[model samples]
Target: MPALFVTGTGTDIGKTYVSCALIRALKTRGAVVDAFKPVVSGFDPKDAAGSDPARLAAALGDPGGVFRIAPRRYLAPLSPNIAARLEGETLVLDDMVIDAMARAAEVRDGLLLVEGAGGVMSPLTDGETNLDMIATVGAPVLLVAGSYLGTISHVLTALVALRAANARVAAVVMSQSLDAPDLNQTAQALIPFLQGAPLFLAPRGESWDAGALADHLLTDLRAP
Candidate 1:
């Protein structure tokens, strides 16, 4: 099974947006796509209309509902470790890995999209970060970042951290941030500093389409 781990420079940087769009695009191309958000915080079961898990489930055609998409969720909008602690719970790294791998196995012939909770270094447990999850899962990463002031630095810094951990970054997506400057220009300026990972721009707008972006990724992944 081929799995792509989606992580961001930080929270609210469009990780879920990119993941959902890509999943839709892949499905448009006749690919069986499934996604999982291993752990989610700030989720309210009673009102999940605008939640990340709900959005993800919708993207996956609401397969088995939001709970199936993200099995681990907390009400506190904080780091997973802190949120877990606040509720008198703890996250076990091995257990998480087991579940993720099992889910991937279920879609062995399709794409398994794993979305991280926050930035690569965001804590999954007291001693584990999202970086560890990526490494343990051995999936290529798609780093999502916001196009804002100082974004280039943040993207490059995140690249360095992932590289140090020997994680393979498939690409870097500069998603348009609220009230940010032109995203295309930001992507252009970021190209020179992105090492070799391809830079992509996700324009800001409600009707923005990701079909073209999805084509680029499929072409790259299917290359001989």
Candidate 2:
């Protein structure tokens, strides 16, 4: 199956939201898209499951669950390494890579979207970072940056890290994670801010449809 991995400059930058939107968008095109959060930190009291995998699975409508795709889940609301330590499981880099590839293969004809935990260099294990994790996965990256203060630096810094790690970059996605008083001002600066990568605004809330977001992504994915 064709696949792309989504990474972000930092946490809470709307990676899951954008990822969900992408999966939902692709599904609209009659594409069976599978999403994976290789390592999730936060816990949801409802599931007693302190992980993003469950949330991502629900968002993607994964009836079988994210465990079908993700092999590890840590419970602490911290970096993966810290979370792993707190939860008593070692974050095995090789295992994660193997599982993700296997999951992508499971959906052989579909588009698989894998989302990384936290920022590129955020720790996944005692000695490994998300960048190292991405290296293991070896898939193209769809970098997500929030549309807020210092985003430009974060985006470029992430792009530099991706390049340093030799990860194929699919594109940079500037997400709307805040309610700016002047949406237009933010929109106008995105093109230049992203250093030529196409910028798409993710509308607020699940109430909004995913059309515009999908269209922007499709255009990027189709670009040479």
Candidate 3:
């Protein structure tokens, strides 16, 4: 099974947007694709239908579309470790990793998108970051970036983190931010720094056309 981990420079930086879009695009092309959110920190079980996990499940046409692939849900809108602790629960990384691997294995000939929470370095636990999870999962990354102020720095820094971990970045997405720079301008500034990882843009209210994105990922685009 081919799996891609969707991680971003920071929270609310379009990780879900990219994953859902890809799910639809891949499905349209007749690829058996599924997504896993794994953990959701700002989840409200009362509004399960409106949660990120629900949205992802809905994209996959899963019936009852709520928390289909999101195993851990927390109430607070904080880092997952903190959110879990507040609810008197703890999210075990090893268990989550094993579950993710099993999900990927079950797909066999298909593709799986494992979406990470928060920025690449954001705390998963007080002792581990999202990068740590990505490392353990050992899947090629679909690094999502924002089109916000200082996003160039954030994107590069995230790349550096992934690079240090010897992770392969299949692609980088410059998802548009509110009141952000022109997509092309920001993307142009980043093209050279991408170190050969393909960069695509996800615009507001427009289809992101994940064809090329999928092509790069499935071909195993590697980081230098």
Error of 2 at 112 (Å): 1.2
Tell me the tens digit of each residue's lDDT in model 1 across 1-224.
36788999999989988888888888888888888888999998788878988888888787447888889999999999899899999999888888888988898778788899999888999999999998898888899999999898899998998999899888888889988878888888889888789877787664667787677767665555
**Residue by residue across 163-197, what tens digits does model 3's lDDT show?**
99999888899889999978899999989888888
Highest-lDDT candidate: 1
Q: For model 2, how does the per-residue alpha-carbon lDDT over 46-111 read when each residue is reduced to its tens digit?
A: 663334666567767764586754556655678877877887777888877877888789878776
Q: Evaluate residue 36 in candidate 2 and report its C-alpha lDDT on the 0 to 100 scale.
A: 74
List the candidate 2 regions with Cα displacement exceeding 4 Å: 44-51, 63-66, 179-181, 193-195, 212-224
Residue-pair clash count for candidate 2: 1
lDDT of 1 at 191: 93
List runs of model 3 lying over 4 Å from the truth: 63-65, 221-224
**Which pairs clash in model 3?**
none
For each candidate in turn, the TM-score is 0.95, 0.86, 0.94
Candidate 3: minimum summed lDDT over ten consecutive residues — where?
215-224
TM-score ranking from best candidate downward: 1, 3, 2
Model 1 lDDT vs. the true structure? 0.86
